[model samples]
Target: MVDLTALLADLAAESAQLDALVVALPPDAWRRPTPAPGWTIAHQIAHLAWTDHVARLAATDPAAFYGSVIAAPDPARLVDDGAAEFLAPSARLLARWRSGRTALAEALAAVPPGEKLPWYGTRMSATSMATARIMETWAHGEDVAEALGVTRTPTARLRHVAHLGFRTLGHGFAAHGRAAPTAPVRVTLTAPDGSTWAFGPADAADQVAGPALDFCLLVTQRRHRADLALVATGPTADEWLDVAQAFAGPPGAGRKPGAGRRAGARA
Candidate 1:
């Protein structure tokens, strides 16, 4: 069984990492535009806080969770709207994010065994919900870091993000209005510590191999697939890389091929 406590601990660490990045920014810095078009650093943090608040509701009061968020009149604009709704002054936004994430962790921990929490379109176990939170926190942190010209060092915590990337292959296809391929696609990535992290069938005909960080960036739509170093063998695997999305939603427009490159070099 997945250790909910351990997952929550990781979630806390991920949130804290992002919090540290923004907590000390000058009030004017909060308005700096991130890679996500019009969204600023403050929007990134607000989005996290908004999601955490709704997720807390999911774990504590499912009815309110659905009624408040899932039932929004315009589901397509829900994400952007949530960020706008939650946007606040830097100090207030930071405090709200910190307190909200803590409450989310407590609520997730108290969820009954075998219970599934309602989400954007589906239900998730407490562990899965926590993992998703970590993924978003890390992904959005990338935006914040990039906005400040910072390149974060990858860590083993990415194992969770990579796992989710692989598991959501079908959802990625569905979100793009494409039928998911049935062929097994094996993925082998070199972790931050130089250990191998493999997923899918060992004998699968299709395969993807690369650094775990690149794969996570690809699936999260944080970077264009071409900007990543991943190699895909076979048609299905190759196509999968193009439309890979780890988060639930419509297919993201993603970054341009060279948009996320570091100073004078590819990321």
Candidate 2:
């Protein structure tokens, strides 16, 4: 299993960094286009802030959380409210994001080490929740960073993201109306700090290997794996490449070249 404490600390630090990045933006930049379709920088930050709030609620009341709140009313209306609520004012958005993040971190720290909290469809431990949050933040941050023409270094915490990607491969393939690939693929990621992470069978004939940042980019569909220095050794590895996903909900349609280059480059 992954280290829960370290994962939470990394997530909290990343959230703080993102908070700083958002606040550093000029007022006009908040309305600037982001990589996410139809979302501005304001929209992206709003989603993050709202997700943090949702996490807190899930931590507090796992059993009733999804039913009473997440599944209530029109989903689009909820999303719109979440986006509009945080985007009310640039300064207030930044303040609320920072303050809410602090509270969320505190709540995470208060949970018992092995207790499982209710999430989208399964019960997740505090550690898993922290890791999931980090993955989501990093993925969305990629959108913002691309819009700003900035590059972020991949961290050891990305192992969590990669693991999530591994777990969701079947879902991605199923969404495309295709059966899951038959063969296993090995993934090896080298962190910016020089730590190495691996997933899947140790002796798998097929493989994907690269820096953790690139792996995250590919899995999140923010960048094509072919554009990076990733190595795919077998048919299964190649197939996995076409269907990798790191986020929840429906599978993303993935990106095509030249769609939005001025926004940012893939890490």
Candidate 3:
């Protein structure tokens, strides 16, 4: 079973760390373009804040949450607001983002474990809510780090993201008008802290293994699986890499070798 408390705690901690990172950036730097095409640092943080607010609303009241979804404006509006606020000398935008995250964490803390909450058409337990938050923060954080030309150490929280990615692979393939592979694929992730995470049956016909950071980057589509030392032992393993996805809504355009090259590597 998922540990709701531990997951929530990790979400809060990671959110706080991300908040600090944004707060420390110079005003000009916040408007600088991020690795996510057309998104600035401010835009990324704003999306985080907005999503947290949406999640909080979803958790507390299901019907009201779905009601608001219909009226929600394009996320670009939030990004515009973020860019404007970031240009100001004060840190109001950062503070607002932090406040939203705090409220989100508090709401999760008060919820009873295993309680089902409405999210879009389905209901999710408090544990799933926390897990989703961690996955988003880590994914977006990678965008910020990439824009800034920095590297971030992987945390245990990444295991949750990896698990979700593995679970979603079949859906990813189907969305692209392709059939799921006939053979099962194994995944082994070695995290920075020396902890390991694995998915799939031990006797699966194919395998992929590497550092957790590399796995997360590949599955998130931030980096290509081939760019890292990810080992794939069979045809199924290679096929799975072509369609890995971490998000639920839709399969993003999968990364190819050109887009997958590591920063500064020759084209």
Top candidate, metric TM-score:
1
Model 1, 1-267: lDDT tens digits are: 989999999999888888888889999999988888778889889999999998999999989987887468798788888898999999999999999999999999999899988887789999999999999999989988998888899988999999999999999999899998999999999999999999999999899999999999998888887888999999999999988888987887877778773311111
lDDT rank, highest first?
1, 2, 3
- Scanning candidate 3 in windows of ten residues, the lowest lDDT window is 258-267
Better of 1 and 2 by TM-score: 1
lDDT of 3: 0.72
Per-residue lDDT for 196 in model 2?
80
Which of candidates 1 and 3 reaches a greater TM-score?
1
Local lDDT at 267 for model 2: 15
Query: How much is the lDDT of residue 243 in candidate 3?
Result: 74
**Model 1: per-residue Cα lDDT at residue 7:** 92
Candidate rank order under TM-score: 1, 2, 3
For each candidate, give its TM-score against the true structure: 0.96, 0.86, 0.85
Considering summed lDDT, which 10 consecutive residues are worst modelled in model 1? 258-267
Q: Any runs in candidate 1 off by more than 4 Å, and if so which?
A: 261-267
Q: Tens-digit lDDT track for model 3 on 108-143? A: 888886688776435777788788788888888877
TM-score of 1: 0.96
Off by over 4 Å in 3: 73-90, 120-122, 180-182, 254-267
lDDT of each structure?
0.89, 0.75, 0.72
lDDT of 2 by residue, 1-267 (tens): 767667778888777667767777888999988876677888888888888888887888665677656565765356556666667578888788877777888888889878888765467778778877888888888788777888777666677788887777776687667888778778888877888888889999998888877778778888766566788889878887887776655566567654543333221
